[model samples]
Target chain A: MSILAIQNLYVSFLENTVVKNVSMDIEEKKVTAIMGPSGCGKTTVLRSVNRMHELSAHASVTGKVLLRGEDLYALDAILVRRRIGMVFQRPNPFPTMSIYDNVVAGYLLNGLRLGKPELDNLVEESLSSAALWDEVKDSLRRRGAFLSGGQQQRLCIARALAMRPEILLLDEPTSALDPKATASIEELLVQLKKTVTILLVTHNIAQASRVSDFTAFMYLGELVEFGASAKMFTAPQDKRTEEYLTGKFG
Target chain B: MTFTEAAKTLLWRQSLDKVFFGVICFFSFLSVLPLVLILGYLLVKGVSALNWQFFCRVPQPLGEIGGGIANALLGSLILLAVAFLLAVPLGLLVGIYLAENKKNWLADCARLSVEILQSVPSIVIGLVVYTWLVLPLKTFSALAGGAALALMMLPVSVRSTEETLRLIPLELKEAALALGVPYYRTILRVIVPSGLSGIVTGVLLSLARVAGETAPLLFTAFGNPFLSLALFRPIESLPHLIFYYATSPYAEWHRLAWGASFVLVVGVLFLNLTAKFLTRRWRVRF
Candidate 1:
């Protein structure tokens, strides 16, 4: 069964329809990739899944999103967000916080003061999982902003994973990293899939195909085609998908 | 040549730029010269006057001179302590309410009233407090002076708290809320702690301003040149004492007033400096 599903999702920006009638399902422990051109509502769809889009004053979304068979749109936003964590395109670790604090920020926010051992284990596990433990362990109390962009991005990912949400939503997680950092994050995501479902948004079909099991092709806020990643890349059913895959158009 | 490049190329001493810069800087220096000279003079005069006995000894009565301002020192401390106790929490809460729950009509009205209260003259505040507190309570007591200083303190504290709270990033609040913490708890735990330093700096800066207030104390804490411990009884304060001795015909009192002025200025300046220094050191890593 699908761990998260969307139906008839319609998002509007002021008077403009950015995403219309978009729907997809993400199976548990699987990586699902959403790919489209810029301003094609790819990030909007990602944000709506976690209800992050509702933060905008002029943006609105309609229809239902179900998480683990429960109606997420009808639930409390705080509850919905707890089960569905997000990482932004930028490395937005709380700048004022330390590396250790950034990893287990979820616990602090929930008022669960972990003992030294518990916090140490949590910081160790999350950082190791995000492939950042080796570099940041010694300087755990150092500010999060002191990390390089790639390291900071991983720390952000580690922060989200610390929440232990059912699924993690990444909005272009590696876009801000260097090629090496990007490759490492891509590798980390491959390992991360065993723990939690990932809904990754990327414009790079190659990266999407490398990391995702399922790929959904969207154009102009509409889902053009979606299926097994290998098939979708090699043999798409729609002309727009073929044009997009072959780099004929954005 | 482009208009911008032409302007840049022609920027020389003969241009209006140099003349304007010199004129503006000259007038600015002129405007600030008095304050600089006064502070310089006070430092030179006061440093020599600050003996241990000057602190330990009590002010000699009327005709007497060359004694410590123990009564004035203790009174200033009491007045400031009481004023801070009254002002801090009340101003902070009102500021937080104005910041967080900016629900159109009510918050707007509250903010507007706070602005008006902040702009009111200290003498008027003294008059108001004297009538309200002293008339009803029957004396220019510590409570009455404290009430006036507290009134002056409110607007500053509120503005500071509001600005500090606003400085906290919105993402931090969202991150807390997303973790299933209630909105109010998130504000109290995350936002408040992060904003604490700036808020404290604001309070200290305002407290320094309040300590220098003479007009409010004129009608409220009027100079009682003796050690006072009772909160409801008449009290001595540095500003009022300084004003009293400065205006008196007695040479002894006049020298004491200048000495007292030196002490008051130094105290306020020291508190303001320490507050800023401590705030810089108290930053949170986590």
Candidate 2:
């Protein structure tokens, strides 16, 4: 079943419309990759799902994003964000917080109280799910800034997973990492789809083909193609999708 | 040009650079010389007057010896505490507003006003506070003195807080917000903590700036001789004590003045060094 449905989504910042009349459905517990070149508005579409697009000054989003048949826009924005976690292109763990505190930051920031043992378990489970528990277990009290770039990104992932969100939105999460780190993150994404729906926006076409169960190709603020990843990669229906897949143009 | 001519020109430029470096180093030392000289002079002149009695006993009558600035010390502490309470919260809020709304017209206006307030003379602030609080209350009180100093501290704290918060990247705030934190909590919990060291440095520097101000206390505190703790009554402060004793004609009073000056200078120096240390030690790495 589809967990999220975007209907006629249009996003604009001031006078420029960036995401125009885009519509797609995100399947539950599946990796859905939004593939496009830079400035193609795939990130904008991902942000609109969690209502983060409104943070920009003069930005306006018009669309009905239904989360499990409920209108996401009609729901409280803060609650929507809580149910749909997001990670940025750059790894931004809270610099002031230690790794253990970062894992429970969602609860801490939301003013939710939990017992110590419960919190400890939550931190371990979340970190383990993000594949960072073993590496950082002994040094959980250290600041997240002390971690390497790849470790920081995993810490951010752990922080998001701690909330147990229904959907996780990633905006070019591996673009800033080295090749080995990118491979690890890609491998982790494949493992993560068993529990949470993943909506990944990537400029790298090869990355989309590698890990995504489904792919949506966007070009110049329009959704050019949406299909199963295997079918789309082998035989793209749209000329633009074929061109982008063949390295004819980004 | 010939290679020899070019080489000669290069040699001349190198000499000019060396001369410029020497000139800068000389002027830098010249600027720091006054502080060193003042500290040395105060130590030489004030050391004899500093004793256990000078710290614990009230000032003695004009011809007698063995006195202390106990009243002034306590009064200064009270006044500074009051001023810190009054200024810090309001200044931080204003600074956060200014940093968040960098392009807003009202924020621009507020920033300009803070700059102007910072440059206003301490004596003018004293006069204004006297008219506002002292004249209406019909008393020269520590409360009035505190209010005056708070006015002086506001601009410094506000500017520092704003500049410190502005140095934090927008992505940090977004990170917190993406976790479903409310806007105010994101600012208070994430943004403020990230810039905490810088904010603390700003607060300490402002406190140091007002700790030695005498003109602002002259009309408000009024320099009492007896030890009193009431906020509504006239009180003595170290700066006021130094000002009064330094102007008097007695040798004993001059000694007391030097001791008080030494104490005040040391206190200010300690605050400045603490600020510098915190800025280095507690700085958040991103």
Candidate 3:
């Protein structure tokens, strides 16, 4: 069953509409990839899911995003964000925090207090889930900035997972990493989808095909095509989706 | 051009660069010469006056051989403490607001105000504080002196805090927000801590700048002779003591003035060095 649904979403910055009448349904515990060229508003769609779009001063949204059949717009934006965590394009672990502190930053920032053992368990579990536990367990007290780029990204993932959000929204998270780092993060995402629903925005068609169960191709501000990844890759219904898949144009 | 000719031109340019470097180094040394000379002079003249009694005893009568700037030293500390308490919170809040809302009309106004405040003469701030606080109370008091110093401190603290916080990438704040942290918490817990070193450096520098200010305290503090800690009473500060005794005709007072000058300069220098050290040690690298 679909866990999240976007209905007639339109997003605009100032007088320019960037996302127009886009709609999609994200399945539970499954990876959905939104693939499009740069500036096609795929990132905008992902940002809007967690109410992150409101951070931009002139950005406006008109749509109903339903999470578990509840309209997210009607709920508090902060509460909505808590339920749907987001990871950015660049790895940004808090520079002032230790790796252990970074993993539990969400709780600390939210003013939630857990007992020391509870926090320890949460940190170990989350890091393990992000596949960074063994690499950082001995050095958890070190600042997160000391980690390599790939390790920092995994630390960010662990931080997000510690909150135990129902959905994870990633905005081209591997774009800033090397090939090996990208491969590791991609593998982590495939593993992550077994526990939490994921909505990934990517420009790489191969990444979408490799990990996404479903693929949505966005062209300009419109949703051009969306279906099972295998079907969409092999037999695209729309001309734009076929062109994008075959590298005719991004 | 021929290769040899080009090589000769390059050689000429390199010689010019060396000349420029020499000139820059000479001028830098020249600029520091006055500070070194003043320190050397003060040490020579003031060292004899500095003793256990110099730190603990109040000034003596004009013909007396020994005296101390105990009251002035204590008063300076008290004024600085009061100024720090007044300035830090207000400066940090204003700075955070300006950094977070760069495009807002209120922030623009505040930025302009900070610039104007920074350029305003310190003596003028003293006069303003005198009129506002001293005149109302009908007395010169340490509170008035501290308020004047706080005014001088605000602009530096606010500007440094804003610039430091602005240098922090927007992604850091976004990272917190994306985790469902509230806006205020994101600023307090993440952004402020990230910029702590710069903020502290600003505060210390501002304190150093005001530590030796005499013109402001001349009207506000009014320079008492006896040691007093009462905030409502007139007080003697290092600069005020130096000004008062240095202008007097007694050889003994002149020696005391030299001693006070030495202490004041050393305190300012210490604050500046501590600021530099803490900035390096506490800097958060992303």
Q: Which one wins by TM-score: 1 or 3?
A: 3
| Tens digits of lDDT, candidate 3, B1-286 | 9999999999999999999999999999999999999999989998878999999999987777887999999999999998898988999999999998898789999999999998999899999999999999999999999999999999989999999999999999999999999999999999999999999999999999999888889899888999999999999999999998999998889989999999999999999999999999999998
Give the per-residue lDDT digits (tens) of candidate 1, residues B1-286: 9998877878754577888989999999999999788888887766665777677777886666578777888999999999999999999999898878666798899889999999999999999999999999888899999989999999999998988787776767766665556777777877887888878888999999999999999888887877897899889998888888788898766666777789998888898998889688755433
Model 2 off-target regions past 4 Å? B1-17
For model 2 chain A, give the 10-residue run with minimal summed lDDT: A241-250
Fnat (0 to 1) per candidate: 0.32, 0.75, 0.87
Provide the global lDDT of candidate 3 against the true structure: 0.94
The candidate scoring highest on DockQ is 3
- The candidates, ranked best first by lDDT, are 3, 2, 1
lDDT tens per residue, model 2, A121-159: 999999999999999999999999989888889999999
Which regions in candidate 1 have their CA more than 4 angstroms from the true location?
A11-19, A57-62, A175-179, A203-210, A219-221, A239-250, B1-32, B47-49, B101-103, B278-286
Higher-DockQ candidate of 1 and 2? 2
Model 1 residue A10 CA deviation (Å) reads 3.7
Better of 2 and 3 by DockQ: 3
lDDT of 1 by residue, A1-250 (tens): 5898889899998999989898888888989999988888898999888777876777888888988779988898878777878887767776567889889988887777879898889889999989999999899998887788889889988988888889999989888789988998899889999999999999987899899999999999998888889899888999999999899988
Docking class of 2: high
